[model samples]
Target: MSSSLLPFILFALVASISPGPTNLLILAHGAHNGLRASLAPIFAACAAAAAIVWVVGLGLGEVLLRHPLAQQVMSWVGVLWLSRLAWQLFRAAGEPLHATARQRFGVGSAASLQLVNPKVWLMAVAVIGVFATPGLPVWHLALVFLIIALPCMGAWALLGIGSARWLRSPRHLQRFNQLLALLLLVSAWSALLA
Candidate 1:
């Protein structure tokens, strides 16, 4: 493998594995829904993130750089959406895990979250700027990111699935949900504050 690819792979792994809003949501979802059900959202999020890298490499990064207001707008909208999700998750903490089917965080929502997430965009831009060399095309970076992200995000889901064992009781599940919700809220808002 090329030396450049190693660094990019490492970068992708760190970015995807890090505890961000998406990873946290996946973890919470997996804990609530199980790995079988959480697979769709996990794939959706990885694909969406890859698509962002591809688009940014295709010049969306330049457009975003030229228009700071657009980033601000997206940041506000994303934060609001995340806040809403967090609120819903918190409110549903008292409900049984099976009762959370109504609050499903599905493929579309996962993809949409990536679209609005400033952190995702920023990461895409960074990947393109730092990794997209003359020999390493944008598509290559995106494809690599997609490949790396899947398992990284899946790891979060697996954690959730594993935690499901301990969350058998309603009270334990409630606390878990509330904690995840709080973390999600903080993760979303911290981007703007940063």
Candidate 2:
């Protein structure tokens, strides 16, 4: 591996693996639905990250970020959408376990979420700015991002899967779900005001 690529790979790993809405969602889903059912959202997030990196490498992300109005609009949209998801999570504790499969965060929604996910945009734009020199192809950089990102995201969900067993009882599961919901809300708020 080229030394030039190491820093970027490390950056991608840390940024993607660190706690974020996507990871939180993955963990939550894994806890509720187990590994098999949690894969969709993980893949969705990976696809979304790839797409975001590609678009940003094309320079569209920088253009969007340069405009304050656009940034504000994106932030608001993300905040509103996240708030809604948080509410749903808060209420999820009341639903039956059998409904988990049907209620899981699917590919479409997870992919769509990237549009409003500031961390994704930031990661893409930062990667493009830092690593997308003339010698490197943007697509390859995107692939690297995906290569590193998918596993990191999956790890979090898998951890949640491990936690699933601990939360088997209805009362325990409900409390776990409610706690995740509260964390989701806090995450949304941090995204908005922080």
Best by lDDT: 1
Please provide, for model 2 over 22-65, each residue's C-alpha lDDT reduced to its tens digit, 9 standing for 90 to 100. Answer: 78888988877788877778888898888889988897877877
Q: How many pairs of residues collide in each model? A: 0, 0
Task: Indicate the TM-score of model 1.
Answer: 0.96
Residue-level lDDT of model 1, residues 12-96, one tens digit each, is 9999998888999999889888999999999999999999999999999999899999988989999999899899889988888
RMSD in order of candidates: 1.1, 1.8
> Who wins the TM-score comparison?
1
Q: How far is 19's C-alpha from truth in model 2 (Å)? A: 0.9
**TM-score to native of every candidate shown:** 0.96, 0.91
lDDT of 2: 0.81
